[model samples]
Target: WDSVIDGNTSMEQFLNIALINAPLEKDYTILGQVLGNLQQAKNYLDLMAPMHASYNSKISKALSQMSLRMSMESYRNRDFQRRWFDAYISLSSHGEALKHIQSLLQSKSHIKGLSIDQDLRWAMIRQLNRYDYGDAQALLAQEKHLDQSDSGEKAAIAAEAIRPQSALKRQWLNTIENNDTMPFSKIRIAMFNLYPAEQKLLSAATAEQRFANLPLMDDKGPVFMRSFAAALIPTQCSAGNINAISDVLDTQTGLSQLARRALLETRQEEQRCVKIKLLLQ
Candidate 1:
């Protein structure tokens, strides 16, 4: 595996051979092999999941720590680090995984404060809330320094404040309302700030019009459109209209596969909601 990772052996050849001959052991060797090469990690994990599921808690804990270490090493590339953390956390129980992630976030000596991105921090907060609401509240209290003048920080604040369990929903809504003339990017952020109930206030046509007027020449236009699609999911939009919006999205250059998947999921959710509403009526 080391030779393969070090470029001595062809990756495709090694992967083909490993698919047939890889040992199903819960050991550091396998963990190290997967962590060392990102290209092969997903395939290797898929191959090993059946065997690895039988491992005892101790081996699982060790692998989780190793994954965290690998993510820390990739901190310079925030997107890659986030992907690593997301992949690692998805494999473990949410409660246990979030507890570990929260500990790492709170440990200032281990990870520098500024190195963490607001999106990643908010993702952790959302997961923490999923597992333990009180703990998430306490974390928000302790991490008040997350407040910044940037749009990302504002978006995070709005999202958290509008959460069903949030104590400051009214205050956050007032803050957003007071800033009516914010730029398109900031408006995009504010859209994400809307709660499910608030989302019903948006018109699908209004969203589509706003999206149409976006200056694609601007580097942030595609990003804004992506966020717009996400923010539209909980709104009272017709599935056909959502599909039309998605068709518009498909024409944008440089939009990522991740963004495209999010748009598709949003459309599916809209369809599901329509079915549920019809069934209830």
Candidate 2:
């Protein structure tokens, strides 16, 4: 983040690294034949990239991204035409980013020809929905009509929960905090979608409720709360939010070790976000 803000690195590079690290952070290397295995992954992805068109099966593309990260290369994943999609939305004005996204969705994306991958399509919709776009429901409904699989159902639930509605935020908060019996599959998606860092105003409404839910998360144990705790952290690029999260870490001793570590890491992420905003401003 500092490197990017200081003009020592590109913003797109920083964003792609962050995206890769989220999934590839722990034990990311093979102990033996690391390069050999990595090369095979690279070979498979290189061979498979051209096959990824209407093929919603993202293993090929996803594997390619992972292999690129492992190789310390930047993620400009190739499409059928090898035409890239700058889908990460640059660190620019929100409206401008939305405009670009809207154009891509409208164009069905040149990268994939006349067809867009199902997962990629929903990802675009979810981004619009996060800003509470007026057509979120209709757009999500349209996509759901196209994909009736289990993955579709989960994505639809996440899209609905992600709408920037205060009531929906509050309702999901209760479900996350109180509904221990809810399957992790359901709750994890809800947790991940419910509180995007930019959605601080919506998050503010239930910020205290989330903080208070820490004990419940700890009681649920590491398996349930490890990812959930980090997901629901009410993060923003502001000192007030940072200190509020920090205070919980400082004074809250009942939290289990994993939950505490998750909180600390998330706080660090927010701090990095704060640095990016401050330097850019």
Query: What's the TM-score of each model vs. the native?
Result: 0.38, 0.64
Where does candidate 1 stray beyond 4 Å?
A: 1-82, 86-93, 108-119, 129-134, 158-162, 166-184, 193-230, 233-281
Poorest 10 consecutive residues of model 2 by lDDT?
A: 84-93
lDDT of 2 by residue, 1-281 (tens): 45753545543454445545534333323212232332332222222223322231233334334432333322332331111222242111145445555666778434323344677677767777776654667888898898889889888878878888888888887887788587788888988888664466677788887787788777887777877776776665567877988899988988888877887887776676555443333
Model 1, CA-based lDDT: 0.48
User: RMSD of each candidate?
Assistant: 12.4, 11.6
Sum up the clashes in candidate 2: 0
